[model samples]
Target chain A: MKRGLITALAIAKKDLQTELRTKESINASASFALVILVLFSFAFDLGREELYAIAGGLLWLVFSFAGALIVNRSFARELPNDCLDVLIASPAPAWSIFLGKSVAAFFLLFIVELISLPVFGLFYNIHWTQNFPGLLLVMALATWGITVVGTAFSAVTVNIRLRELMLPVLLYPILIPLLIGAMGTTTALLQGEPMSGEAIASLRLLIGFDVIYTSLALYMIEFILIV
Target chain B: MREKAIYLLAILAALVMIPNLKTVFMDLPDEAMQGAIYRIIFIHVPAAINAQIFFTVSLITSILFLVKKNFVWDSISVSCIEVGTMLVLVNLVTGSIWGRNQWGIWWAWDLRMTSQLMCFLLYLGYLLVRPAIAEPTQRATLSAFVAIFAYADIPLVLMAIRLPNVRTQHPGPVLETGTMAKEFHAPFGLGVLAVFLICTALILIRQHQETAQREIDSLRRELHSI
Candidate 1:
């Protein structure tokens, strides 16, 4: 177990180091998120309230879709050098690899969100002072939920023929529940509401999703990587 | 023998649905609130129920396939996907028509409707992912896993849907109350039975064709080896 954790962290470190050298995943993700935010801001050019009302969904849209891109690239990056094979052949369990890859994805996405959210706030004139801590909490939990499923599905679709196409098709549907929770919580936060019943319900849903999806992924990763 | 039973059931299902349609239109009075627009219930409710049952069957067969490593179980799962997806599409269209009549909107993100849509997407994803993986065994395992995963998360998704039940457009569960009127019960019972029979017959027939196709593929491979 101790060695498994070490192997997981090592794999995560290896991924981050490779990312540092290439900056492939993060650069693409940040730019894609920015573009989505820009386009949505333009499209909702009608009124201020309308923009504010949709910012939560728009922000999450950027995160979710760009996050899918990051997941696709991270695994595709492994294919050229066969690093994923090496990782699997190592003394670590496949679930540990899932953990490692998910950990790396979490940070990669966090960096993108850190850069993108402020721009979103600026464009939409968001008052970050409204439940900022709760907003941060929502982003963390929701991103974790996304990362957990994204990492597992990245592995699942990496070997398919239409590998690029398969990732989003398989993933986004499963991510709907998470997106609902994240969007609802973010909307509530943006509206300057206290953690009301609906917000609490959405939070609990996110927490539930993170637990269920993570455990299921861990349980199922070994089966997924059977090839 | 299974094929024969399937054909027989198919004919019986067709026969039953004839009266089911008549009862819905000519005999049963319009629902008090929605008027004649509620008559779509004969088609919509039966298809919706069958779609859900088909999904559950897929889930069950998928679990059995995973446990037993049986190709026949996978065939059943695949058949369920095809039939279930088609029926869910029907449900969506019928519900949309009814919604437009009732709510003056083509679509509303209600819990039941949205859950049905999500369920449809999950099944569609399963079908889309099927052709991407080339290896037969790997495909079976992966698809079966997807079926189970979709089934397992359904309750969670339903709970998430209902957490903020802002739109209550569709009616709640009917069979659960067990207080349904006798006049309403008879035709609905037949409608439900007809749809189930049709679904079963389709799956069984498809399962046979799949088995035969597998055999032919194996024969082609054998001839090539010779």
Candidate 2:
């Protein structure tokens, strides 16, 4: 188990190093998120109260779409020149590879979310700082939720035809419950409410979703990687 | 024998169905609240039940295919999904029509309707993903995985309807309640039985066609090699 964790960390480090050099996934996701925030402002001309009401959904919508850009590449990046094949051939177990990709994706997406938040605050004129801790917790859980499912599905769709298109079609429906949980909690947190009954319910749903899907992805990743 | 069974099932479905339709249209009075629109329940509820059952069957067959690595199970799984997807589409359309008449709107984002929509999209993804992979084993394996993953949503849908907080415009199990009169019970039960029979027949027919299509494709591949 210790060695497996090391292998997973090593794989994640390699991915992060590659990403650092190119800045491809981070740059694309962060800018895309910002563009979406700007676009939402343009699309809706609501006042402060309305903005506060929808801010949670709009924020996560940006994250979900932008994060898709990152996670879609999680395995697809290994496709060129048979890198994925080589990785499978290596001593690292499939779960490690799956975990590694998910870990890397979680960090990348969290960073993107973090960047988007302040800009979102500025544009929407809402102070997220009051509920900063709760908001951060919601963001982490939601981001991890997305990363787990997204990374698993990235592996699923990487080899299929029109893979870029197929990933979202396959991933979003699965992500809906998690998104609802995230949105509910975030919406509550943004409104200066902390740990309300509804928020607690959403948190339970989110945490349950994460546990169920993460274990599923780990158990199933070998089958996905083998052939 | 297989062909005979298909015919028998189809005939049985029609026998139950024709009488049930008559009971629905002729014998039963219009519902007290929903009036004539309530008649759509005869088809809508049955279709929803059949779709859920077929999708469950597909999930089981999918797991079977993965564990056994049998193309036959794969064929059965795909057949069930295709039929299930069609049935779910019917459920959605009929439900929408009922909603339009009863609720003064064609759609609602209430937990039940939203989850039903999500369920439809999830299975539709299963059907859509199958064609994108060319290798037989790979396609079977991937789609089976998808089927298993998508099946998780089924429980969520069930939970959504029962969640106390989330509002649902969709009715509860009317059969268990007094909303549906005792007279509607026999026809409704018959409707469910008929739809199940029809769904089974459709799945068998689709599996047969899929097997034939695979044979033809393999033969063509062999000819090209020659």
Candidate 3:
């Protein structure tokens, strides 16, 4: 198990090095997120209260869309020169490769989300920093969930035709529950509410979702990658 | 034998269905709070139940296909999803019509409704993604992964209505509460049986077509190679 994790981390480190060299997906996703945030403020001219109520939904919506942009490229980047086949043929197990991609995606998405939160606060005229720890926990759990599913699906769609269209169609529905949990918890935290029963339940649901999907992706990635 | 079973199921479905239609429409009294519009549950609830059942069938077959690497399981899995998608559509439309009457709105974004819609879209994605990948083994493998992933939502949909945090306008199980009239039970029970039999028949027919299509494609490939 330790060796497997080390292999996964090595793969993630390689991906990070490649990403650092080029800075393509991160740049594109972060810029897309910022553009969407600016456009969202223009789209909805709600009052302070209404914006706060929905700030969670708006923020996560940006994250999901931008996250998709990043995750799609996670596997797509391997397409040139048949890098995917080489990666699959390596000594590492398929689950390790899947985990490595997810870990890298988690980093990319987390950075984009970190960038988006303050910008979202700026445009929406809300003070989100008061409950920083709570909000960060919510973001981390939700981002992990997104990366696990997104990376697994990236593998599935990478070889298909019109894969860009196929990825989101295949992805968002599986994400409905996770998004619902994230939205609910984020909304409550932003509203300056205590960790109420509902928020706690939502957090539990989020954690449960992350665990289930991550394990599932680990178990199923071999079937997808080997074929 | 497969053809004979399909015919037998079709006949059984019709026999079970006629009494259900009469009982639901003519014999059962109107629900106290919901009135006659509530009668849609006979169709709606049965479709909803059978849709879940068919999805389960697909999930099983999908796993089998991955394990056995057989095209037959792939065909059965895809057929179940197709029939299941149709049933989910039926459930959604009927639920919408009923909601229009009862809730004064055509749709509600409550947990139950939203999850059911999510299930529908997920399977619809399954169907949409299949034709995009042309290779037989790869298509079967990838779609099986999708089917298994999508089936994870079924438990959530089942439990969505009962979750404490989210507000749901959908009713709990009336049969369990014994609030449904004893007369309503006959139609409801028979309605489920009829829907399942009919759904099974449709799945078999579609599975046959899918297998035949696969054979044709393989033959065409042979012709090209020759």
| Candidates in order: C-alpha RMSD to true structure | 2.2, 1.7, 1.7
Which sections of candidate 2 miss by over 4 Å? B157-164, B172-179
B-chain TM-score, every candidate? 0.91, 0.93, 0.93
Candidate 3's residue-wise lDDT over A1-227, tens digit each?
Answer: 78889999998988888987899999999999999999987898899889888988998899999989999998999989999999999999999989999999999899989988888888778899978899999999999999999999999999999999999999888887788788888988999997778888878888888888999999989999998
Sort the candidates on TM-score, descending order.
2, 3, 1
lDDT of 1 by residue, A63-107 (tens): 998899888875677787787688678779988888988999998
User: Compared with the true structure, what per-residue lDDT tens digits does model 3 show for residues B172-199?
Assistant: 6643454666767778888999999999
In candidate 2, what are the lDDT values of residues A1-227, reduced to their tens digit? 88989999998999988998999989999999999999998899998899889989999999999889999989988989999999999999999999999999999999999999999999989888988988988899989989999999889898889998888888888888888878877888898887878888787777877887898889888888888
Candidate 2 chain A has its poorest 10 consecutive residues by lDDT at A200-209
TM-scores for every predicted model = 0.93, 0.96, 0.96
| Model 3 chain B lowest lDDT segment of ten | B156-165
lDDT tens digits by residue: candidate 1, B116-165: 89989988999999878766678888888788767766777887887765
* Predicted candidate 1, C-alpha RMSD: 2.2
Better of 1 and 3 by TM-score: 3
- Tens digits of per-residue lDDT for model 2, B1-226: 8799899999999999998898889988987777787999889989988988988898899889889998899999999989888888898899899899888999988775777788889988888888998877788889888998899866654543343376667677643364666788899899999999998998899999888988887898899999
Q: Candidate 3: which stretches are off by over 4 Å? A: B157-165, B172-178
Docking class of 1: medium
Tell me the lDDT of model 3 at A114. 91
